[model samples]
Target: MATEAKRQKVDDGSESLQDFLQWCDRVGLVLSSKVYVSKEGTAADYGMLAKDSIEEGEVLFTIPRSALLHQGTTKVSSLLEKEKLSLESSSGWVPLLLALLYEYTPSQSHWKPYLSLWSDFKALDHPMFWSKEERVKLLRGTGIPEAVDTDLSNIQREYKDVVLPFMIRHPDLWNPNTHTLDLYTQLVAFVMAYSFQEPQDEEDDEEDEEDEEEKAPNPPMMVPMADMLNHVSNHNANLEFTPESLKMVCVRHIHKGEEVFNTYGQMANCQLLHMYGFTEPYQSNSNDTADIPVINLYKAATQGVQSDSDRRLIEERWELLCQMTQDKGAFVFSKQGCLTDSELHTALKVFCMSEEEFSEFKDNEGWEDDDDEDDERISQALSSEGLLELKPSWKQLIHEAARLTLRSYGDGEEEEKVVDSDRVLMEDRAAFKGLSCRQRRALQVRFGQKMILNRLMELTKL
Candidate 1:
């Protein structure tokens, strides 16, 4: 396994790391002599390493805006704009994907050296590329299966509806045979894996206070050399944007031989695996989360309330929750097993309320505005005992739901196949090492979730 990882990393460092470094210089990307890219035997295969001891807040590298590959700088930018094709957060990453496709021809592309750093589609580990059986066998209960299906459906529609027509209209721009769905999908994976969303303008900080849902995000761009750093849950470096350039700055001191780690945000293991094709093992992801679907919670909450009138009452209570909190969907639990979602707690309290209690609660139109402080006080008061002190019935329902959710991952025997922690991996290396990369990652994702759910069970234990 280690040998395969090394080989793949070497293959990905095409044209050699030195050539890519020279390319970075030619394109106005400045790399601090303190750090350089190398073949890291870690999950990323290739990662930036500290060449010398670096102090906190030190700039590791700076990439000029001109060096970025996006719709604005691509060779087809003007043509795309002229054709009235604009990409935004809503329309998916088609714009950048298209630009990548257009610039992928080595002879024509100015980014030849830069482009050579990437491996072919075979090297990609995103679940979108997983076999159907593999996905079913390993990722049955996770959101990945549904997410991958939705992505494939959308990609096909995007290809047939938008991409094909655009390419067909301009035959010289792209070849149908060469820019096939397979290649388009590969570009999609690249965009997902490598693209960086342009930082929001600092001048718009005040305006950003508006609901984020109402805002259209800046287009994703490809930043050469910036995407090489590997990610860890507790990262020591961050990417900071300035008017002139995007800078990678160390947040803490990095000693020589230490990998210069950057964060991919406070993401859960599931999200990391889904987007980047790898996850931090042994529940080490600080931002790891597991979701218990609202429907599952509802099923658990209404397990014994079989009468039509009682069911109606429960349905009405759920409606009330939606109206009051706008929180439908799932109850998200953090890595520590604490329920991070207050809305879910409120929902549980509402459901567990007696008929008269619910009447009084509804008549009061939920808790008063000032109740937030009281809720906080109550939460603090309960923290000494447990995260949240739920009523016996409420705890029962949530515990049952947590069990059901865990069971959905598969049987206990199957769950035992994957290592759950770093210590365990060390103790039983063969259990984890024998599995395929995809299988190992799949287990990591599910097991990370299972760990979270187990914590949830503990939190709500009756």
Candidate 2:
């Protein structure tokens, strides 16, 4: 019975997709005869694929700016003009959200065919849609939980302060009975999933220079047909914007039957899953990253300092290190499951020194140059061979810090069990369906972080 229901939903979605494509044709979108949108044997339900061999640098399609669904392109602009509504006080997202809401109305919307292509709210797998319990259980240690909370709170506030008042003024456009919180949530989800930021042209930037508050980049937009392309880590297609149109051009040769993919920039599995509702497996993702909370490391470094003077000195040194790293813009952690060389070196140089070594370095106001013997000494201490020479207790502290981070997720035994079970389930298509899409995506993110934490702990052991 459930299987039949699922099939029905897919069929409905396909019909809507066909309607949208037909609408695109009616509006004069120039699509290549060599490619078409259809289901590929991958996780994405719909993706564009090459029907014939295509060379690098070929133009796949071109979408005229007028066909895009934005304040400038759609009926929303006309209605706002008629109503004398000014959205100057609100964020760019406010007007775009209103534009989406306007087009979502069934009888009044001119863009109904395009709007109908979106999946129902229940189909959204974004972490924001997950229950608080699920977030605590799966995302407690990660930054995603806090980010999801902030996004939901902000959107709710926007609806109350901005959208609700506008709807009250325009009763003909929004009937309270039909436009409920449920619909608002769905619209926000669609925008989050589908909106594109129209790149700010250099000419516009020059014009805005005299404005005291530099205007925020032109609001993100919804590009019809263009949003249909799915992402791959190393994609072969690129989206370029001009004064007249948005173009999808091939960056590399696409073999017949291969999916034409677009790069979403370098993103971690966690970010991809949270924002886009899917994750490439760790092995398949070249850009996979693990976000380590640096605060955990700070706590670990200062844990055993007994003397207040000594503690102050250590804190001072740590602050200097942080500023130096920040100046270079290199403090971020990643999924190759390790800290950057600079981060590792900074942490070791700051925390792994004896009082005598630290005092001498401090007297010099920190290492001044690469030629300094003290600087070379600190560098050598961070090397692999120097690991055996370090005090075992200092090494233990680093191990304990990583272990604490992993523990922040949940019980070690339970986390391991869940990760192991999911790994096996992921390999079996039948078993995979037992979990919701968000659950599957969240598990992959958690698993990736755990692997990195384990690697960090191993480094400490060495």
Candidate 3:
């Protein structure tokens, strides 16, 4: 362990989760690919969630430095170049620093979590740094957007979702780094979440005639500790961070053995489902989209467990929980464990799953999008693009399921395409069912009732 890592450790006796991740090799649930897109229906796209209990303002989890690749894919020669420096820090200085950390570490296998950070940072709107010509020269090897000086003013003007906590105490780190070493100066958690982006108003664009479409600020390129809380729209997980240590300190008190969840879809269900790809567990009908509660997931992690599908889910899910917990949920940590793969995977795998199943009981009456035949509201057998996490086969099923449930976009242009009923049925029958009985049931919580209805509706739409 490096000196920096030691300094960042929160060895408060309150935590049952040890300082380092113990199960990286034995675990496969942590999605290794870090490049996740919020909107494009990626592997992170596990459909409808099973209902999990949570309270308002709970500290879902903490970010660990061990899982996060600090300098993110350091191509040393390219990064030093003036042009490519933009690529190194496009998400701000965070990736660049992580890349530096990656540069120093000798052990490659253990560095998966940190290396994954590079992709996440790049996905954000690249922060403008040097002049176009200078940047172009430096950006020779690694393929990314052509380096161009973005108007710093434009960046600030467009800064809501891309916000991060920063300490005014240090100008050096205002750029970005792997850890919070710079912010540690103040004893107090003086750090404030700041953004290179500025605020925007509805009335500011040119021509005033509604030519510009509304776009959200990109998800923060470098979540650092702030990304720990699983994505949830409600304040249930309520994750917060301090600028002083750049550590994401948990403000909400959590009980021991709870699965930590972050605010995954703090935006909306459609946004959450299509983007991160996991459909939150909720009952939806025309009269009740708002009533659909958005809650963060927290699994109760048992102290001991053996290898089994049930155990895998529990362990994988709770790995995030344990890392985020401090001394049995009593205290929260900041600026440490950024490199822990389990936390990174758990955070990345928000609603992600391979399949979901929904069924309507013989007497069940409630359903969504019943009238719209071409509705994409919920559907099956559809394709998705821009989903970065899951493999093509994994996400193909999600796309199909989503198509079955939702209203199709634009005059039924993107509606689900039909396959021969017999052929599809044969395929389902011929293939081996991968999940165990318990695992299948656990997965059904996301796709159970409404999803099945959507599939039935698709038969008519075609």
Candidate 4:
């Protein structure tokens, strides 16, 4: 929603727009003339805007099933079906990427005009496209680098085993020079940035129910013009799917010339940057989250040099705590990166349980048939007032663990610098000039996590 310059109008007479409209008409798609694709000032290069005032619930466009580009609708489906290519073992994106690759070739695709309007690969700033050195500098301490590496490995394997073999089998259709690994990476990025996982229809859900196995829903799909809408944390429009078509509808009233924004659900800055190459400031995003790696605490608790008996006791206590919490994996901070009282209570209980108490709970399988005394004690211990009963040593351990996790994000000097800044200036200057977008977004996530950890550590003091 930040605008730094005047909106530039795209030429209505442009050949690509004309061709896209003609193609839509040929495919029985209905686009309202009231909306047009145009510059979105500083938000994005292209976004759809209302040419006239639109009311809530009004349909902006409807894309028929025939116009969707997916495994089932693309022309390559027939060829893949002929080859008996079983996508059962492949990830959801595999078949979709193959379908996209097929459609991208010369003259064989009916969706070329629509595809021509896609954003350039060079312009994309998703972390997957970042240089190795950039990633090290910007995302070294974060989980994003590991995720990026995993994605790259999976795509490489898919290309080597599935896509490359299929291309080799059909050399006449796929020229080697045109189907390079670089193109595959770009297409994967394109799919990640634009694809949507549509919900299945009622009939399909019924069929899945009858089938007993209840397989996952079909792969995500590429919807051409619908992908052009820019995202805002508080969006005014959303996509509605029916058996016959996919419709984009105004979810709220819009004045004339206002950009039609679409919601991408509640995502954190890390997720938004990882997928869409953009980040919203903390003030604008109501659903921001930060992840605290509790696994690090588990490791720290178990791996220290200790007497054999002491180490065994610690491991048993840790295992019992994991069972009690159902190993919730990570301590997730929500609501603008602050944990709720209940969440803090849960963390405190998990971190502070004594070995004898854990053994008693384990013996009872969490109070399944608890005697009155045990039941009374646990009920009091887990109550809101029970937080006051935590031992001083347990509180110190929790405080130390929280501090260690925060320190893992950076060296001592950098952590001190981030903690010293006024929170307002940190948020306002997140996009500091001269920093690459990836670096800025990474900094925002790191800063948010440190702030949340600081608050959690303060609670331990209480």
Q: Score candidate 4 by lDDT.
A: 0.67
lDDT tens digits, residues 187-296, model 3? 00111111112223334544444756655442232333333233433332433433222232233443333333344323323233212222333332111121110111
Q: How many backbone clashes does candidate 3 have?
A: 86
Stretches of candidate 3 exceeding 4 Å from the true structure? 1-81, 85-235, 247-253, 265-277, 284-462
In candidate 2, what are the lDDT values of residues 365-441, reduced to their tens digit? 66545655454565455444554465676567556677667767765655445446546765676776687655666
| Candidate 2: residue pairs that collide | 289-335
Q: TM-scores across all candidates?
A: 0.89, 0.79, 0.28, 0.82
Question: Pick by lDDT: which candidate is best?
Answer: 1
Worst 10 residues of 3 by lDDT: 1-10
lDDT of each: 0.74, 0.69, 0.29, 0.67
Deviation from native of the Cα of residue 231 in model 3, angstroms: 4.3
| Cα RMSD (angstroms) for every candidate in the order listed | 3.5, 5.7, 23.5, 5.1
In candidate 4, what are the lDDT values of residues 77-149, reduced to their tens digit?
8776676454434565766777777778666468888776652466566788887777766665556777788
Error of 3 at 113 (Å): 8.1
